[model samples]
Target: MSPSMPDTPTPPLALSPPDLRPWRDGGSGVDHVHVRDSGRPGPTVMLQALTHGNELCGAIALDWLLRQQVRPLRGRLVLAFANMAAFERFDPNSPYASRCVDEDLNRVWDDAVLHGPRDSVELRRARALRPFIDAADVLLDLHSMQEAGAPPLAICGMTDKSLPLARALGQPATMLVDTGHAAGLRLIDRGGFADSASPRQALLIECGAHWEAISAELAIDVSLRFLRHLGVVDADWAESHLRCPLPERQRLLRVGEGIAARSQAFRFVMPTHHLMVIPRAGTLLAEDDGHRFFTPHDDCVLVMPSRRAGEAGQTMVRLGRYED
Candidate 1:
């Protein structure tokens, strides 16, 4: 498990991890991948879950959809459960241990990594799922945060098409326009999804806290909305399943920079909340090694501040500003 604050005890596992054994031998020839085709000609929409095994909301959401036998009304719909090997090892007593077996599955999406000789559990899986991801016209990768009570965020990667799609979803309320992490490429930013000229777009939603019951609810609601938005699922059926009310409007936050930890001693001056806006410029935020981080501009927003004691080069927090 990653090193979290010593003062804070581990939160209770509020949501049970779903039994995913039935989905092992999925329809797509790839394990845990199910594809439904309308055979009518439309965009292929893919909903992916369990990129991180600890983030159970997405897995619960995908399992619920599969159980409901949700099919596309127009084109193909792909429901994939990624990092199942890691997920299979999940124990409620120590939920954080199974995020990945070797490395984060979400980080090995770069072409060089996938095509390289270096082999790992996550890389193999990413390679296996690459074809389906390539074929998708729209992709929604569901995830959850480490910190509790943080608001849901749509991670719209650096692409013109992504922000517009997030605006269309309208629920999550807050959208973040960010480049993929420095460590590696995220699944959402891979291939055509990140290409401005390509019609394909992908979004990664941070639903809420990993084990929160409400996170699962939000995940399902977002999935329904995403499917409905893509015209893959019937509007009435999707609407019936949506439990959350639409936000009054969506706000966009453009990430200016991600503060990566330079040492194991990295820490914030105080507890920081997600989407917390600091009114003044040059306010103290965090310190790593000998370097200190401060607000670069007035009305600076803190996005996804890490509660854990970060490893060297891990993103401790991202600094952003509201666009609207």
Candidate 2:
């Protein structure tokens, strides 16, 4: 835990609603903004939706949070509908309409690309949202996975500033891995570096079931809880939203493979619902062609599998702490 919070509130903060925008996500046609209760001055928290495009729960959850008049235990808030284009393009009746139109928007968070020529819609939007990201002190890039029983998890890197949140949201699990900042894949994780210099806490909640309501509710509850715990909202309101107490200790799983990949034989993996103990050395993979498979250590509960199984990809993960 970093030495930033006190056992009690010294100076209360205020928060407004999250601001939304469509100008940044390119021209796929989905654009949105949500601003709430901004009269109070507090820390700036930005909640965004549709990072994966198909993850619908977060979008609804954002709508719920935006519609409320939240009393900040103390800061400002900014909410955005990240992918209005993809949201509009996909029909609820069609499950596989299109997770993305041109490219994966979640993977395209870079400032320099704003002026560069873009070959795809993903690049255009990434360039547009640079400023909102730059202004935020904390970002909860909400997402959902195609896994069963995800149990709601929060992932933060080695940033000490935001680690408190990981500890507080200790539900499914937490991991502190090197996100390959040079690759420009994880913008919020890498972009937040300027605020704390050393690692600052960032949240990537994998709620569960791409379109399930449970995932969305958990994401929203935990987010509001975060605001409360950190003085962003009234502690009472946040406390009312608590589903799970903070876990004393959480585990971090290393990516045995890249997060975005296909398992030729597996569609997805539910790590939290397993009973077998995982071994430390190899990976637990959906191998179809006789490659090898392994998991973490002797007693670890794994969650969130990249299910797009097929071919050997970098998305398979191994669990570990930053120092380990």
Candidate 3:
């Protein structure tokens, strides 16, 4: 197996964070929600960004959409910048510091959590945006990876609802079917979005590592393709801004489970990259204070292995495989 690159003292700041002050007021009743409806009437397509404040690729992509004045010809297009409070704290020197001011916005989508007494910057924003999210016929949440050199992939969740949409997109060769985090519910996992029979579908794409220029470009390319797929934007418009190669074929991986770091001392047997395939069953992968981890099955694949051992209960990496 190839060795992981040495940790950079500071990851290069490849792109500037977009200034989103103009979009804060929003067209919808809520803040950061802009909706444009075509009189012809079609699906209400939503493109969301800034779910995690540290993930700037999404913000840059949304900013481009607003700057280009991209509008729907048939369906309604909703451009939302979620968690502005956290995004306000983004600093190039500490790129990962502002993931969220209080709690992870992506994990607070559960109906109970939205309606409960627990309150924070993320929860409030998610609560205010639930109605808009529920109204979306198709949704795309943009994000970026934590580890450098990881390939971009479309996260289609554990269900088949998003599988067709994943295939329709022109970029990203790998599609991951995830069961989601045990810590909380994600927006993609909420209501009809995850139901196989429901017309409402959503996908989250990790567009390479945060703070990299390539991630922003990947976000824009994928977003354009997604808009084209829903007929929210014309092929001509999409083709004009296309900057990446279309995948010849796509592979599907079904995530089995996430391996949590028991403590800050957790360590992998060797540094692993995202999508690394393990050939044998019971292969040693990692170890914590007194705990050990091994592959549950043969041909096991590692998805998004973290460089940081991380605190207790944080996901170190996820184990997955090709869907047979």
TM-score for each of the candidates: 0.96, 0.71, 0.95
Candidate 2 structure quality by residue, lDDT tens digits, 1-324: 001112322221111222333233323233454444456676667777777666766776676665565544445666777666666675545433446667667556654554566667666666656666676677777876554454555556434455566666555555444343333456555566434664344677766556555676676776776676566776776677666455566765443223333345533333333222355545454343444444534543343434344354534333332232
- Residue 66 alpha-carbon offset, candidate 1, angstroms: 1.1
Tell me the tens digit of each residue's lDDT in model 1 across 11-51: 88899989998888778899999999999989999999999
Cα RMSD for candidate 2? 10.3
Give me the candidate number with maximum lDDT: 1
Q: Write the per-residue lDDT of candidate 3 for residues 61-131, one digit (tens) a residue.
A: 99999999988999789999998998999887776777888888888888889999998988989988999
Candidates 2 and 3, the one with greater TM-score = 3
Candidate 2 segments exceeding 4 Å error: 1-31, 36-41, 71-74, 112-115, 158-161, 170-184, 194-200, 241-249, 254-277, 280-303, 306-324
Stretches of candidate 1 above 4 Å error? 1-8
Best first by lDDT, ranked: 1, 3, 2
